[model samples]
Target: MPLTARNPNESENEQDASQSGDEKPVLIEIDHVAIAVNDLGEAIDSYRESFGAVVDHREVVDSDGVEEALLKVAESYVQLMAPTRDDSPVAKYLAKKGEGLHHIGYRVADCDEALERLKSLGHKVIDEHPRPGSRGTTVAFVHPKAIHGTLIELVQE
Candidate 1:
């Protein structure tokens, strides 16, 4: 049975029918799960010992003041992130929240569209526009307060 995807911005027949219930997932896939830690090396070592996961990509996103190690797990990644500077957001997050799961990256077909959808639904957005993310993906962040205290990243892979 096909379920109607009602969009107030569109006409009744124009409403998208792509999503017809739980039969189809709204997001493409789980892009990565980011964990903010005090020490990237220590976290990487711990994952290596416990799960034998190895770093597939390592990048220091100077713009975000974070050094990240991407450990591949199937099609997704376990992103181990550490702060590079005192004023970095990650540093602030760690200071306030301590080392733990930061934000979840959910793969999307179109980041701009996803962002618009969230905004249309009256959700608070951290990034108003899609920006460059690690690994050449375009991304936007949906504010945690809007998503029940879970930071959501819309990733266009």
Candidate 2:
């Protein structure tokens, strides 16, 4: 079934059937709120001191030239990311926009399906297919231009 908004008045059975079909709800929950920073350690420290957040997972994504520190927040995470190289996208983003909100990662049941559904809806995508992401997840990026300047990442773990 194609991805569509559930009717507010739909019966429980109807809602279940729609969601349980070939395509499920694209978004499960907000996996993380990504923040781009100049210094990952400093950002981590700030979160730690300010909000009692601690690093749950940390990884250097060589492909993206970024090092990320994931701080668990409830069922989701606050992902602090810094560019490992000056040429990385995060670095460019920092140079242009300064340290701040970078992207939002939405947990999905199927990354590939979510990506495909977005494409079929005429949304611009950065990744044509799902790729390996930080923390052992399958992920794909949808272009910011397609979503009112907010970069959206579909993450499946």
* Model 1 TM-score relative to the real fold: 0.85
Q: How far does residue 68 in candidate 1 sit from its true spot (Å)?
A: 0.6
For each candidate in the order shown, give its overall lDDT on alpha carbons. Answer: 0.90, 0.91
Model 2 stretches astray by more than 4 angstroms: 1-24
- Clashing pairs in model 1, backbone N/Cα/C closer than 3 A: none
Q: How far out, in Å, is residue 112 in model 1?
A: 0.5
Model 2 Cα lDDT, one tens digit per residue, 14-46: 765464554556688999999999999999999
At residue 151, what lDDT does model 2 achieve? 96
lDDT of 2 at 74: 90
Model 2 has an lDDT value of 0.91
